[model samples]
Target: MRTVHPTVRLAVVELRETSGPAGDSVGASTSTRGVKSTQPSRPTQRPTATQSPMDQFMPKSMSVPKQGQIDSALAKMIAIDFQTFSIVEDRGFRNYSNSLNSMYTIPSRKTLSKSLIPQLYESTQASVRERVQKATAVCLTTDCWTSRVTTSYMSVTCHFIEDFSMSSCLLDCFEFSDIHTSENLAEELLRVAREWQVDGKVVCCVSDNAANITKAMNIFKWTHYPCLAHKINLIVRDALKGMKPTVDKVKAAVEYFHRSTVGAEKLKFTQRQMGKPELRHKQDCTTRWISTFYMWKWFLESKDAIISTLAIVNAPVDALTQEEWGVEERGVQSPGTF
Candidate 1:
């Protein structure tokens, strides 16, 4: 055997080391050549310090808010819009914060209602006054209604043409005390108008044709327009008064199923068996005559399913009587005939 030259032996050893375990000649040549190597160098990692008990469970990156930032954000949340305490206390809301979790603090409902709401109301009231001052003419609408607790409330709305488009805003809603007579209503309406400085700008006032409301408008001496919708509603209501017996029977049937869970479930089952889409009966409102039309229409549409459901629930009394059924059939056939 001939002895290898020292230079040749050195080149061979260099090539073997560059070839890597896969022994690719191209990689070996690219690395061994005088050209700079294109391959990346292995990263040198330093040993990390041992984590503490808390760090082990904590997120890799955590955001810690400064005390001032947190307080400012909390105040904005309360003042920006009306939100309930239960919303902030919701399980999903609490779990959404990764940084503070149990440490995150939110104000209670009492704190918001007594402090934040009043502060916000003052600021909003000033803003509304500013907008109202810029309007050339404003139309006023007022309505009074009693709540579930029998507390009376009067709502006032302002409408004006802004940028050639009609825009409206609710000026205020306040509890009305004492008897709701025309004199009392007129006093309140004029007070609200004067407070907003819109009394002089008021060109028209619209309201339902309640005797008290019309009388109030006369006392205020404002141009009054009876609400056209209310007139139409009155006509419809008067016409339907004769059909009350039939309407009442249908309403009772619907109320029976709606108020009882077992009856509702039986209705759903009956609807499925009849291959009908599940529909809940609509209830008529004392003020809204259109609701009565919807109630009757829905009853007629789902008459078969409703009768079947009554049978399934063993509620014979709740089912419509023969005369009542005939009335519904005729009403459904000629909805306009009524």
Candidate 2:
């Protein structure tokens, strides 16, 4: 037998021929043959792990802070950041929170006002009680004030030594609707001290020199001291009566600058030209004697700018005479003025 080549024996051959019937009616045919192809089977594939459809959009529940921690932080935002309860209801703030986390929801304003705030207040009260109970001796400072709406309120604060470090805490601030008398004020103080468990441990009480407070302290029978700052204020007020004319001029100047926009701008411009800080005149508050000192001090510091501004603008108030300016300078320079 003739030996056929191995390559030729394995190779598959295909041939094709086309025959046309006639030019008007043509027909064609074709055929193909090939050996079957054998490709190595691919290794079997293991199944893949998959997340659920909801998992793609949902944040990890475990990653969110606990409800208690969120409430506490919200409480701090109200107390420390001075945010109002209605802040929780703001659309912009809610959108911002949603952008940060979809899993956690902000507490409603009603919930914050009714639940979280009160809860935080109770927790803080408990902490204050614990600290106050451990003190050997505590000094109390209390005061009463009336709001612009004529609402009366009282506040108490405690000071003590803890671990050789000075510590202080505000015990309470509550509305005192009753008449402010010695008996009523004493009762309020006693109530706060007893509630905090510091009644017997209080060494002294310090308060302003108002008549009602003074008499209340007397009735409380703890060693009572009038606030030294109040006494100094009294001294300063009495000492300034002799210099009314000079004080009046300075006060008028401050009032003029505060009321007139043109004068103020001119003053600032003059200060800049003089290479001085643009310090504005301070107005004195009748209740605060220190404000008077600040006013006098600022007046002297900006005397040159004030003179220039007054000359430029038709000042409504009388300008200070050179002699009066000298007196103001001397008074401010003297250690006793402040």
Cα lDDT tens digits for candidate 2, 257-285:
99998889889999999999998679998
What does candidate 1's lDDT look like per residue over 172-231, in tens digits? 899997698999999999988999999999999999999998988888689999999899
Given candidate 1, what's the lDDT at residue 69? 52
Error of 2 at 265 (Å): 4.4
TM-score of each: 0.70, 0.74
Please give the lDDT score for candidate 1: 0.76
Model 1 misplaced stretches (Cα beyond 4 Å): 1-82, 97-111, 311-327, 333-335
**What pairs collide in candidate 2?**
none
Residue 134's lDDT within candidate 2 is: 90
Steric collisions counted per model = 0, 0
User: Highest lDDT, which number?
Assistant: 2
